[model samples]
Target: MYFWFLLIVKSVFHHITPVPKIALPTAQGFSFIALTDILYFKADNNEALVYYLKPYDTKTHSAVIFKRLSDIEAALHYNGFLRIRRNYLINTYNIKQVNNRAIVMANDETLYPSRDRGKVVEAYLKEHFYI
Candidate 1:
């Protein structure tokens, strides 16, 4: 069953891989972000916030876009990045530190934990990172 599932997933994503360029305001300049992990972001304006995930790079400025966060997650197979919480989806690479109430970003953007999701998020992070 697992083998069949693997085949199905491989074939499903064989042609839908992301192909875009990410331009960052950093010393590395611009890069070809072949596949980036974007988490769901919904604001009051019926839009979503998205950031590009160019792993293992030294870029700070992420491309923020308004999108249908739910739709994007379903198509991505939930593979590359972990949806830690509903409102906050971070590319683990850019996650600098996790305190009790917030996840700090490389750009010093301290995003607060979801209103009712601190304990769950903390436990998940600890288990996943062995912290």
Candidate 2:
């Protein structure tokens, strides 16, 4: 019984540990983006544009990185980021409103959620609101 309790406690502690930060390369050097700060990732050809949330700013700042949106989506999915479209991976925490099939982000950007992913987004919103 003690061994089982110890194992469960260890598992909980492991899950609560902080995830590794993502390093984004820039012209100057690199920027470390925490999972909580990411607003969304937009695919632009072979590059992915990362938008980050900033306090006291109405708009989010963006940076282009040489990575695929799918790749970023996979890496950040466990951190509350969801791929709502083929070209968009958005942080669920930054969602402001849901208008029909579209989502309004905290930065006031309107993005269309994919038809197949609409239900998923709705469920997430419901869970977020504890409704």
- lDDT agreement of model 1 with the native: 0.56
Per-residue alpha-carbon lDDT of model 2 for 34-94, expressed as tens digits?
Answer: 7777788999999999998755666678989899998888777778888888888999878
Model 1, range 1-131, lDDT digits (tens) per residue?
99999999999898787554333333566544444433223332444455544467555434544445565456543443445567555555556787777787665667776666677667767777777
TM for candidate 1 is: 0.52
Top of the candidates by lDDT = 2
Say which candidate scores most in TM-score: 2
Local distance difference test scores for all models: 0.56, 0.84
Measured by TM-score, how close is model 2 to the native structure? 0.75
Q: Report the poorest 10 consecutive residues by lDDT, candidate 1.
A: 37-46
Count: clashes, candidate 2: 0
